[model samples]
Target: MNHKPLRARRAPEVARAHILAAAETLLAQGGVDAVQMRAVARLAGITDAGVAHHFVDRHGLLTALIAYGGDKLRAMIDATVTDWLESEPDIGVLLAKLAGLYRQGYSGLAVALHAAGWRETGSPVLEKVVEALHAARFTSGVSAPDILHTRLVVAAFHHALATDPLFGTEFRRSAGISGSRDDGAALQLAWWISVTKRALGYDE
Candidate 1:
């Protein structure tokens, strides 16, 4: 006797979420190139048609993926800010977390998306960081100039973190550090954290 296969029924939003999550896993494991529709569909336990139905095509999928990553990063920044406000203000921890996210293939995705004509009109993440740091500095009795400097410092740090995943090792090697070692990245992050702390008056 032949048995009919069971079909898994999920809401549209649920299916989309599953596909996006699978794509994210593939992206984290092998950059954007690995987030093919077939792979995502397989991982998502859905059909290729299903993935296409949601994202339309590869470009659409990638665009949505980038937006998804941005949302996650925003949430992380918000949580980090809340924690810093409620407890000890640790810029180093926040910097490290930002670096962690970028290193997880989101940096490459951002670069690819930008190269493909995706333009972000505003720097919401940077603005949030600046705002949080400004508040922290103001509460610590830091001078007006120092508090205002938070924007520049945060912007620089954000740029460095975003580019680090793509060029960090080669850049470090060019500066005479071993390319195979992560020591250079660690040292760079430490320096940024120190600079940020000094700028925000957290070093005192």
Candidate 2:
């Protein structure tokens, strides 16, 4: 298949997008502090001045990145739900996908972004994404009992990924999972998926 090449006039816009994408990855991997201008420039194969030219400053870059992430996240959830609606709509599969997303550390990034948004009194984009996520999970053909169980699963996963190692360790021990912390986390997710599936009246 022949693909049309990007126009030269669009180079600056493409570069800005690359910088934002790199910044988003950094934010996901290490929260706000990791999204340094130099690092983003390096990842995007552009100069720091190039990043600043588009975003003006680190604060400006971060503000734009959060908005980008919120839009991206909402699009992802919407696509997943649209696909489900057209095919075999399985809430269990969607829940498992959400658990996998949490396991990949997106949840930690989201927690950090939410804290920042709360303190800054802004970030309507992130707030809107969160509201949509809550509605998707709790109101999308899920029973009351299933919603309660799903919340329990989310709570457990959140505690398992908590920064307090002692709390996480104790929670893992009480849950009777054996292995390294990461392994225990995987097992916890698996168990929760089974529980959630059953709660949703799925046998497997």
Top candidate on TM-score is 1
Which lDDT values do the candidates have, in the order given? 0.76, 0.63
TM-score for model 2?
A: 0.64
lDDT winner: 1
- lDDT by residue (tens digit), candidate 1, 1-204: 998998868898888788888987887667778889999999988889999999999889988887776666667767766766677666677777777767666677666655545555566656666777777666677666554577788878888878887899888888887845367778887887787787666764
152 in model 1: Cα distance from truth in Å? 1.4
TM-score of each: 0.81, 0.64
Per-residue error for 13 in candidate 2, Å, reads 3.2
Per-residue lDDT over 73-140 for candidate 2, one digit per residue giving the tens place of the 0 to 100 score: 55665565556545655555665565555556666666666654623334532333233334555555
Query: Which 10 residues in a row give candidate 1 its minimum summed lDDT?
Result: 113-122
Model 2, CA-based lDDT: 0.63
Instruction: Compute the lDDT of residue 51 as modeled in candidate 1.
Output: 96
